[model samples]
Target: MPNMGRKLRVGMVGGGGPANFFGGPHRRGILIDNSAELTAGALRSNPDDAIASARDLFFTRGYGDWRSMIAEEAKRDDGIDYVTIVTPNDAHFGPAVAAAEAGMGVLCEKPLVMNLDEARTLHQAVKTAGVPFVVAYTYTAFPMVMMARHMVADGKVGEVRKVEAWYPQGWLAGSRESTADAAGQKQASWRVDPSKSGASGCGGDIGTHAYEFVRFVAGLTATRVRARLKTFVPGRALDDDFTVLADLDNGGVATIAASQVTIGAQNDNGFRVVGTEGTLEWSITDHNNLKYYRAGEPVHVYRLGGMYNYFPSTITPFIRVPEGHPEGFHEAMANLHRCLEWQIRAKLGEQVPDHMHLPGIADGVAGMAFLDAAVRSGRQDGEWVDVEPVG
Candidate 1:
């Protein structure tokens, strides 16, 4: 059970549309286990939309703007302990900065901000405010992924030699000749627009996830990268596909790719880590199962919720059921929310479980740096580009 001694008072920014489109999962996840409650929210960019969203979500206090939410909440003795930023890539910076300045912990959506400069500024702001900040990297919270991290960290896989990670989607594979003005088209609009989604579209949207996941599981950073980027869709403003060869800090190499134009493929995000001793492989489709290989031994498949002494103890709390009861994407997202809630409680001087520590601002910054460098490298004709190390 989550610690009920105190509920982390929470406020949300951007709940107007699909919460997942903004920051809904974080709010729902925190509230799920009774560890946190949604006290207030400035849910939309527009005043009417914000109020409507708040009422729909049943928030007690609703404000049209995030500034008002922060200001009003700060004056109360029982003010919100944390604020969640779920706005668009361009909109993430303002609310997050405001929340931090108001002395609130934050859990913002990934890609941190629209660009590297904004990411750096937000990082500095959070540090100056001295509050816990988390970036919503939903994949890292998966039980099996956590197990993989543990295995790699414990030398279960020995020294890492190579890694491969990719996220491919077929949603945008339509013929470009069929449509004009892809900008205003629902799915490809904001994403393909450089101004809204940043310099690279698919790279920033899902490629960053691939980069962060591999790094998290293997516990390494890319020192250099060589890449290619493409816009398969005709008349598209940004690259819809990206591929990269990364040089890892630990003398290992990684191949990373993300594409929105893979026809018939649906959410094919997966990774395989190879080491001197053995290998570990997993995919988003078969998220509950992780394959473990040891030289001269039959491969072992570990399933989530399975009773295995070899499983990492760090993931025990996240396992809610016995093995073979499938727990997939949404559950993984919930785990991140659970961790964020615990971290928020710890900040308020309340007891939090040991597994509360998840990827935070630093991880988000690293993801942004990866995107920035990858795009730059791709533009330079796959030249070896030194990735700016993010702390």
Candidate 2:
């Protein structure tokens, strides 16, 4: 807490070299609160790329490997208060576990690891280290999404009967020059590789985002699922399209789906929760708005601002701008980072609210369970698979 008035010093792991898809959003988002600084980075596997990224990001210096960076940074009096892991799936385990064991706070990209066991081990380490940790499940931090959660808890949607969620993108639609990615040329090339991305591709990537959205909004757990996963692209090692039917803990049901091969869909992530009284809808494409429907009333659209009479008062504090102007993905992520930063400050003896929380290790573990069960059910031809929640 010696640097209480200063920004939290942040060290980095891997993202991408030239420019990463994840790192930009994360850094932009965390800075939205002006709570953290990107003082150091180990941006890529190649030492040259890492150094180049450090220069581009204006870091104090770049190291060749995360272990070297972590160890050296730990020796500083103003050493990184936290580390951000933006590496790919296979690369997450070593650095994250090592950082937590080293007593540095960790905020990692999702899905937290390639497997649930890794998640459990990381969880244990964080607990023992007593450091704050979070997985970047960014969508849950959206203002409207939180409003949806507030509404569900308020029974604005009544008794939740069913939920439907899907994240469809057209990014992986066509054939790739197989050699281009192996030579480390383009973005997301590792996503289709089983060894690099994990067991299921589409479901593990965006599908888990949809799954988290459903649970976050509906405030219910899907204990089991019946799923089908498919790979449309030729010579692919994992799935690109997946659909799942889940049985909720409250006896409700959900249809969850995600696809990277949907032509023209373009990151269309959305969900609808149907309750006995009404239904709630939200889409990240139209992120600022949350639509609501009641049995005997007109549709109510709540924008992400205080001027809206329809929006609950709880949402006002999170609204950063005027009514018509929209808050976006960066803002959503910023909110999550803000919450996490507050928790870090609280840990450092600065007073902060107790109910402040974001998806942590248990949620990360549960996400792995979701992906694992989907793969298992897909293999067994749409059989039911149970999801035991974990961080």
Candidate 3:
């Protein structure tokens, strides 16, 4: 592995469109980390919109079609090292596959593809190409969340016994009222449509986030799941809420839920894990503090970038300041960018920094399996369904 003086050239596939809320944040993350540059992109599914977004986003070049971007970029002397896919659920697989086939590494948004089959195929393609690939499970990059994972893995929480996680949003509480207008209607349209977003709706969108959070923190795999899924709004095309009970491989249990109809809650994503000796709790709303408890002792607060006697090596870089400066969502996203940058550097034959690891293909496969099994279990009236382990 050799270090190069220049930054990695990058291209994007579906980030510029009406459907993007996190696209701007992702762009900012890249610049903040000093990892890569937006060299080119096929920014939207629509050709005109793609060209317009490229200029607005300041890409050096733009393409109406993703395949054209790949073909042209691959022929350049200074080619793009990575391509990011930030499209709707159904659009992820094609661009990712094209990017991989063109000999570029990839970072794709969550719920890897529309279904388990697509996920498996994409996973295989990345593996066969031997490219550095990552699924953007954004919460895994949070500093406090990383601290919580370190605590559990270091045996500070003892043997994990149970876990609970949820993500509640109020956006879809009254679908008619929310999507009655054209703007809201467009935003809510493709998400609920099966052809574009796949089988499960809210679960595929946010429930996977909750499930991924628990698995990442607890270091456990769910072996079986029983779920209840429902669509609370009339005429809504997909399930907006879900409750799932998971049987872990380590003989533990996890309860998970996600809903867009939880009124008054906005991005309330959090989780709690209990073990034989103590418990760990953290949430997105309170991004900087992690609550830890031990039996018969006062609760301990582990502030972000705080001096702690037991902090692990993997969590330190994300901490920019001493205790209480408040590193929030952007920092979490920047951490992910830093990790991907290091991995891309490694792929280009450079030495990667020690703390540069993020979730990869395996995590995406697991997410898909969880989604499929949960939907199956729910449809079967909460009967327990065995989740096939992804190797």
What TM-score against the true fold does each predicted structure earn?
0.93, 0.93, 0.95
Compared with the true structure, model 2 gives a TM-score of: 0.93
Task: Name model 2 segments beyond 4 Å from true.
Answer: 1-4, 177-185, 306-317, 353-356, 389-391
Which pairs in model 2 have colliding backbones? 361-391, 362-390, 362-391, 363-391, 364-391, 365-391, 366-390
List clashing residue pairs in candidate 1: 15-43
lDDT string for model 1 (38-96, tens) is: 88888877798888888888887889999888999999998988887776677788989
Q: What would the TM-score be for candidate 3 when compared with the true structure?
A: 0.95
**Per-residue lDDT over 146-247 for candidate 3, one digit per residue giving the tens place of the 0 to 100 score:** 878888988988999999999999888887435557646666777788888888989988999999987789988899999998999998888999889999
Each prediction's whole-model lDDT (CA): 0.81, 0.82, 0.84
* RMSD value for candidate 2: 2.6
